[model samples]
Structures are given as structure tokens and as C-alpha cells.
Target: MVNERDPDAGTEHWLDLGPDPDLDSDPRHPGGWRWWSLLVAAMAVAALLLTQNQRATHPLPGTDPAGASVTRSASVAARPLPESHSPPRRTGSPLSGQSLSGMLFGASPAPTAVEPAGAQASAVSVTDLGHPLLAVPAGWELFGQGPGIVVRIELGRGRVTRTSVPEVGSASPIFFVVGHDRAIVHPMDSVPGYVVRDGKPATQLPPALDQAASALPGPDPWHLWAETETGTATALSLLTLDGRPAGVQVPIPKDATVQASDRAGNVLMFGIGGMYDLRQDGMHRITGGTLLAVGPTRWLTLECDESYRCDSVVIDRATGARQTVKASLDAYEQNAGAISPDGRTAALLQPNGIGASTVHLLDLSTGADRLTGVTTSSDQTLGGRTFVWSPDSRWLFVTNGAGRVLAIDRAGRAISLDVHVGAIDQLALRTTRR
Candidate 1:
């Protein structure tokens, strides 16, 4: 029997057990089983205390058994790192360094070279002829020639057609394409002009143009202005392509010279004092400046001092509004410029002092000026080389004095034609016949 205390009853009770032989033999140690029981109770109490100490050191997550995140203490809050300071990485576009306007207008950054299918034999120095970037316009023919040969280029197809005109001889010829298969050809001297059809002289021009000193095309394609001088008197007579008189002869100032003409048949003349505008009604003197180029509505002129230092200005014909364009310091007497057909852009050639001219483009609307990354060894004189624009106003074709031509766009991208003639004195875009 085991003795247990019932505290509620305040009495002693006995736990009954069966007799055991081992309990009887262990007389030396009385109540030994009770001692074993006390030792086991001490071990159990130690284990419980150890478990509670571990829980206090490593507390449970802040969440109460649900997934909701509990608020942390202020000392344990998180913070963002500082912002980085680095330049942006560059892109791989060929036009990387170009202006937004250039890119928007189809200028490529990388240099592109396109060699026409049989162009190996006529290939000149690649250094002089820049790479080809864009395709030429369709149905356009570029005409020029060397001694005894007329060179015609079908730019759209990159085709070169040569016609042998023995009449050209060794002298420089002044020619203009009148029809797809015919042109008006004359020696630069006092020789009478003739019409050439398919590389052969077809017929002589009318007697009225026999003593014409010079011929200028346009105001329109169907009409021409023939300058004829008799003794000390000089007159400009308008004529049709077939050599018939279109208008009466208009007397010109002896000392004044024609600078440019527009599609509206208005002739701009410059003399010692100032500039004059000649229309069908009468002649009127306008602003005083050296005229550079003329568009449908605007005109470009240069005002220079005695030292030849000059400033460029764009004048509006209707409102007479003047807007000064930024020009290079090197733009002096030797510089030449032309405005686009749309009157939105202007190309200026500044002599580089080493027999080369650098091309510059100006935006008339915003007064933005930029380099075209193009240089030419052409003569910068008004009568030596030509700067002719495409009818669409998208491309500008210029001669390189060496008989080759370079085409440039408003975006400043340029392409050199793979052609070589002796000396290209004149360049004219083929116009449509009426």
C-alpha cells in the first residue's frame, strides 16, 4: 500500500499494492522506490523550464497564426538605397550623332556605299566619291559630257548612257535637254545653236536666236529667255522651245545682270546700286543685296562689306519680311548657295581654303544651321559649277568640277555618283515637254 495525502479531506489514505519479494529483501534501504520517484520528478521539471527559455529567446513571427503582416518597430524599419548616377548607353543606329530633324528626315548614321553592277571600270577614288546612302529619284536624267561625248545618267536605275557627238569637238558646250531624245546644243562661243536628236544634229535653231549671247530656261519648262546684244544695247527676248518668239524683247540695263528667275516669270537683276525685279508689267527696284538664290516665294541674298565679310538674309517677296540666317565666318566672295524649291532649306558652300568647299544647310523656318558632312572640289563661282535641285525638293545635285556629281538631301546625307567625265561645265535636270 502507498500512502497519499488528500488535502481537501484533511485525511491520510492508503494506496493498496500486491506483495513483492524484492521489496522484502531490500531492508537496508527503506522506502527506496519513493527516492527513485523523487529523482524522476526533478528531471521532468528541468525539461519543462528549458523549453520555456528557448521560446522566450526566439519569439514566434509577428503574425498571430494568420497571414497578415504585423507592424515592426521603428528601429527595425527598411530603407531604399541611393539613386545611381550614370550616363545612358548609346544605341547602334548609324545616325547616332545626327540631330532629331536629320533622323526624322531619313539620314543614316553609318556610311553606305552602293556600287552599280558594272561600275568597276569607271570607279574613281573612293575617298573623293563618298558612299551612296539613298536611291535616286525615278525618271530623272542627269546630262553632262567630256570632249566629243555626251554623258547621260538614268539616276533611278544607276545606268550611264554615252552618246558620241562629234560636233561637240574639244570646246565646252552649253546644252539643255528639251525632250527625252533631243536637246539644244551650242558651243560656248558665237556659233549658232542646233537641236540634237539621238546623238545627231537634227536641225538648226530659228534665225532669231542666231546671235543670242546666252539662253536661260524657265519661269516654266516651255519658255526660254534669250539674251541678245546688239552694239551697246542688250535685250532679253522670251522664246518658246521651238525658237518662236513668245514675248516682245524687253530692254535690259547696260550694267545690270540677271541673277535668278522664278516660275512666275519674274526676273531678278542685280547691278552696281542695288537689285531690281522685272515682271510682265514693268521693272521695279527692290532691296540692295547680292542675290544668291530664288524660290517661289523667298529669295536668298548676301550683304557684304568692303573686306567681303558677309551676312545671309532670306527675304519674303510678299511681306518683305527679312530673316537673317547664320553664316560661317569663312563664307566670303568665293561662297555659293542655293535655296530648296520648297523654300524651307538653303545650301551654302563655304570655301575651305584648300581648294575644297564645305556644304552647309540652313532651315529657313527655324533658323537651324547644320553641316552636311559633304565637301566638294567644285568651283564656287556663279557661272562655273551648278547647284540644281530636284523638282520634289528632296535632293540637291552638285558638280565636283572633275565631271562627277554628288547628290545631297536636306538631312545632310550625301552620295557620290560613280561617274567620271573630263570636265562637267554645266548640269541641268531634264524637264518634261509640253
Candidate 2:
């Protein structure tokens, strides 16, 4: 009945209901006890844990948190805040009374700043290859005589190397006699004139009225001349090493002295006999005669006797201008002169009016240069003819025209033992001749 809800149209069935009270019944019920006992046990356990923690240890000084203590930890260690109190401004005139506090006690040492080993940075350095090792630097192994006709000893790494000079244009089968390394046969011009390398002829020009009284091998940039007869009065001549005809040939009156082809590709003809004019290259009536390499980029014209020998005239190759560039020696002649492969330096001959010879180098950079005595005389009959400049520039091999191949330094000092000329460690060059 209690489970039924009153309504004008009532419903009866109900389920899942709790007991409902009625006013007319009497009953007795028992209550569960001892609930407070569990609570008391919990409090006792917490108290024991607190006591153990406190008695365990009192951490030495700073080890314990600033104010983190058994009792006052919350008040002392809890983050301390900045005060709103402002400092008092300074006033002038004072009877300076700085009060001292009670007996100052011990204080903790300030932490060391530990000055940083200020970071050190690194640096760089590079050797400039200027003048051919012109003065042996240090640490160079001389393999052998460099490029030429017979076997030329090479001095360099891998495939890049330097060797001996092969006989280019000559009479007979003048070879690179292992003995005659520095000496070139007196007359390089052929009678029926043809350019020959090794024993073979490379090019041939008709015989001319006049052949160079003497010949000088080219500088680094080789300067060459050939005289071939076009007819009786006029002869065909060229300034280049290879071409069907010379780049240019101007008419000459039967005789001309010095002929030169500069790097600019211009042909020049001049004579230093007694009184002369530039017979070619349009440099008409220029004084002085024999042209010699005076600098890396300059040439020298020496005023000599009718034989055409004098102090060399140095001219700048770039502008084809003239300046007297003299070697320290009083008198000398060029059996051979070479501009260093480095192009920044050069090698030359300082001949003793007799047979001995010396070597020198012209430094293009500092304008400072030097000369060193390289050899005594070389007779192919006795020795041979050839002296090759080492590619490193540090040494020059007095290898040819002498019985022995000696190594001379840039300053003209003897560095290596003299090696007899041979094929042991040399490069072979075969000049083409027909």
C-alpha cells in the first residue's frame, strides 16, 4: 500500500523499494560498534613516522634547506620575498658616524669566479712557388738530368717533370752526348739549312746570304730565328718555331746583325757591328746590339765590338722598352741563358774570357739577383755540353759538356755529388729530322 502513489486513476505494481515506517509496530535492532578504534591506530602510526624522521639526522649546516627544519621550516625556507622598504637618499655634510654591529662572526667563502680559459681560435699559413725552387728550399730529391735529346733525368712528382734540351736545329748528328751536356756545337745553323731535332730535320728554309754569326738558345719563352735563301738578293726568314713561312720577313740589304722575335709576336732586326739600325721589327736606328734576357719580363742589348759583344741591354718585354740591365761581373757571354720555368726568375752564363763559366739568376720580384760559379770548361771531346736548371729552381745541373754532372745551388754552392752523364735516370727526347 505504501508503495502505491495516489492519483485519480491509481497504479498498483512497484519494485526495488526500501522499508517504510508504520506507527502501529514495535521492534528492537542491534548497532555495530568500535569504529573510533581504527582512527586512533592511524594517528599513532603518523606520530611514529614524524618522530623517526626528526631523530634520524640534523643535516650539516647548508645541507639542510635554508629554513627547511623540524619546526620552523615552513617560516624560514618558504620562498623569501623582497621588501617594499626604500633606501634613504644621501645628504652632504655628515659627522660620519657609521655604527658597527656586535662582534661580526664567521661567513661562508664567496664562490670562485674561475676566470674562463678564454677560448683560443686557430690560424692558417700557404708557400708561394715564385722562382723555380731557384734556391733549393730543402727536401728535394734530384732524380736525374731533365729533358733533352738523349735520356734526360727528371726532377718532379708523378707525370709533371723537367728534362734535357734535345738538339733542335743543327749540322751533323750533333747529339746530347752524355758528356757534352752544356756545350752546343759552335754553329747551329746548317749549311744547306734545315731545322733538326735529335738527328732528324724538323723544318727547312732555303739557305740565306747571312747566318747568325753566333746563336743563343731561347729564354723561358723561346726566341728563335732562321735564314733561308729566297733568291740571291732577298732571302726568306722567319721568327717563329713552326709555320709554313715566317710570321713576317722584311727586305734586308744583304746584311743584318741582330734578329729578334718578342713575345708580342713582332719581328725585329738590328745590327751592332760598328754603326747599325734595327734591320727588322720596325725599331729603326736603335742603338746597342746583342739582346739578352735581363729580367723575367725584360731583355738586354749589349754594346760589343764588331764581334757584337758588350754589356747586355735589358728591355721590358711588355712594352719593348729599353733599360741597361747589367750583371755584377765585368765581362761575360751567353753560351746559354734560361728564364726560369717559374717565370719569376732566370738563369744565365757569366763566361770567363777563357773557358770556365758561372751561373746567375735574376729575381723578378725583389729586383734582387745573384750569380754562382758553376763550372770549369767543358769539351765534348774531353767531356760534353749541357747544364740543366732543376725545376725546383734550387739547383742547376752542370751535366753537359763536362765529364761529370754536378749540382750547383742558386747562390752557386755545390750541393750534390757529380754524376757522370748517362741514361741511368734521364728522360729521352727524339727531335724529328728528315
Candidate 3:
């Protein structure tokens, strides 16, 4: 009886733990079923979204991965390279096959191959620097004089620029010593000298020397060599426009005078005794003759024999060696001449025992003489002197008493140049770039 009574009580307790049958239809229980359903749908949706996100971030096998595309873009960016900016070599020049960096930083231009002593020079084209324009090469200029003024002639671009010296007189005979971009002009008169640069105004050069003669550009481009006479003694002086001497002055003999000088710093001295080399230490006696011209390493002297015939001697400055060759010239009239720029030939004007004179070309290396067809009077002057050798030693520009300008080459052919103005008073060659 006791066991049967406990079974019903147990059933009641179990039913109480479950949902209330009557409360299921209540208003508060309305949202309870739908809330569980909505939770289950949201769980399914979250699972779908997570699957799509994983597929986007990482590809499946056998398909291209996102990282692979990224790698391909990186590879394409590294494909191209840039070009170099070096200069090309200059072929066939004296500076052949040289680079710009080598020339600018560490390398020097190769030395130009020189021809043999007796070898004939190749032909060169000649251009006259006459009046009106005074046309010249691009790097060449007439620094010595201007038209009625102390001026500088800038030649380039097929045009001529005559820069007048506004500070000096119109009639001044201006002589200049030029360097890289600088120039110093001495008026060769009582006026003081002046300094000028590429883009600057003219300024005075201090401590001018009186009666300076036989002036060459310089011991160097920046210095000047001049012969100034003080009382009885003629001094072989060296000075710069800035009042500084490159070296000490060398005193010449009392009666000795500077006859001829060259750009190579060799001075020819002639006095009652003979010729002397005015060195910085003292005077070195050279020869006994009238000094004619000075070359790079040789001095041309005219020594006469008993027959009144003069013989030209080429004296080596370093060895004191002499090569005496008879010059076929009228020794009484045209006794002076100049050596070729190459130091291989000598040109003299020989009179044919008449009033007419011929140009005698002597090859000093081979001692061979060739006569040119050019003829002028014995009294004629070439640029107020005898003759001028071209800087290349290839031709000679000659002037006659008729005021005709002729360019005679090695083949003895004379080419006449047009001279619209008067006779040429002075002539100079621009041998190097400024």
C-alpha cells in the first residue's frame, strides 16, 4: 500500500520539472518558440558567411592563389633597367679613344706624332687676317691692335667682334700678353699698361718700364719679356703687368742689345764683340754675326766671308753645335731671314744681281736649296719685315714693293690673297687655343 502511493507522487514531481501544460497558451510564451527558431537561423547564416570569407582569403588547390598574383606584380616592377650616361670616345684625334672622365680627371692628351726632320709638311689652308673684318678662326683673335683704337678682335661664328679699349688713345700701338682668359696690354708709348679679363673692365698695370723694346709675350703666358734701356746699359728685363717679375733681371753688356727673341725663352744678344745668350745667371757668348732670327732651339746667324758672301749658321742652344750653310742671298741688302717653325727649313730672299730678288728655301736637315717663283724688289718689305713663316711651317706669307700679298707653299706655288686695305704693317699667328 505504501509503494503504490509513492509512484503517483513521483509522477507529479517529474511533471512539475517539465513545461506547464496550461501556461503554454499564455501571451508571454508567444515569443519564446520564435526566439529559439531565430537563434538557429542566425547560427546557419554565420556559418555560410565564414565559409565565403575563408574562400576569398585563400584559394583552393589547382586554382591561382591571391599571393601568386601579388608575386607576379612585384616581378614585373623589377624587369626594366636604365641606360648609362657616359660620353663616347673621340676616335682619330690626337686624343684618340679617350673618355671624357679620363680627360677631365686623370688622363692627358696623347702627344701628336711629329714628322721626321727632313719630311715635307702636308699642305695647309691659308686665311688672311686683313682689314675690314680681320676674320680668323673660332679660337683665334688679333690681340695686338684694333682699328684706330686699342681693341681686341674676337673671331667666331663667321663674325668679327672688335672690342675697343675705351680707356686708351685711338692711335696707341697696343701690345698684349694673353693667357687663359686674361690679357695685359702695353701701349708701347709713354702711357701706362692695362689689364683686362674675359668679362671685366680695363685696369692699369703698375710700374711701367720706359723705352721697352723687343717684347715677346712672355717667359710664360702670364709673364712678359722686354728690353729696356737705362742710360748706357740695356737690361734684359722680365716683368708682369702686376709689378712682379717671374725671375731676377739679367744685365746685358754695355753696348749689347736684344736683336731677336722667340716664344721659347731664348734671347739673341748682339754687341761690339759678338752674340750672347742672356741667361738668368750671366751672358753666354754664342757667335760673331748679325743676329737674324731665333727658333725654338736654334739661333740663325749671318757670318760673312772674304768674298762679301754671307753664310747662315744654325747654332743649337743646348749643345753649342753649329751648322754653317751658305745662304744664296744678296748679303748687302736682305741679310736677315727666319727659320721655319719646325726648325727644319730656312727661307731667305736672294737677289739675282739685279733689282729683283727671289725667295730661297733651304732644307737645313738635308742642306738642299729650292728657289721659289716669287719675285720682289730687294728693298721690299713683308709685313714691314722680310718674311713670316706660317706656324705650321708649311707656307710663307710674302709682301712685295707693289704691296701685293702672296702665300708661297712648299711647291713654290704662289697664291695671291685679296687685300682691300693698305699694306699689312704687322702679322702674327695664333698657334694654340686660348
> Whole-model Cα lDDT per candidate?
0.59, 0.37, 0.52
TM-score on alpha carbons, each prediction:
0.58, 0.39, 0.50
Which stretches of candidate 3 lie above 4 Å from their native place? 1-214, 228-234, 241-243, 304-310, 330-335, 349-360, 366-387, 397-406, 416-422
- The positional error of residue 55 in candidate 1, measured at the CA in angstroms, is 99
List, residue by residue over 163-269, the lDDT tens digit for candidate 1: 44334342433534344455555554565455544434235556665467656554565667677775789877777766688876778888887654443355666
Q: Check candidate 3 and list the clashing pairs.
A: none
Candidate 3 local lDDT, residue 110: 62
lDDT of 3 by residue, 46-137 (tens): 66757766776688764444434332112111111111111122235333555444554468666543323321111111233534332334
How many clashes in each structure? 3, 55, 0
Best by TM-score: 1
For model 2, the local distance difference test gives: 0.37
Model 1: runs farther than 4 Å from truth?
Answer: 1-137, 145-148, 165-181, 185-194, 198-207, 229-232, 259-267, 304-311, 328-335, 379-385, 418-422, 431-434
Pitting candidate 1 against candidate 3, the one with the higher TM-score is 1
Residue 302 miss distance in model 2 (angstroms): 5.1
Best by lDDT: 1
**Where does candidate 3 have its weakest 10-residue lDDT segment?**
77-86
- The TM-score of candidate 3 is 0.50
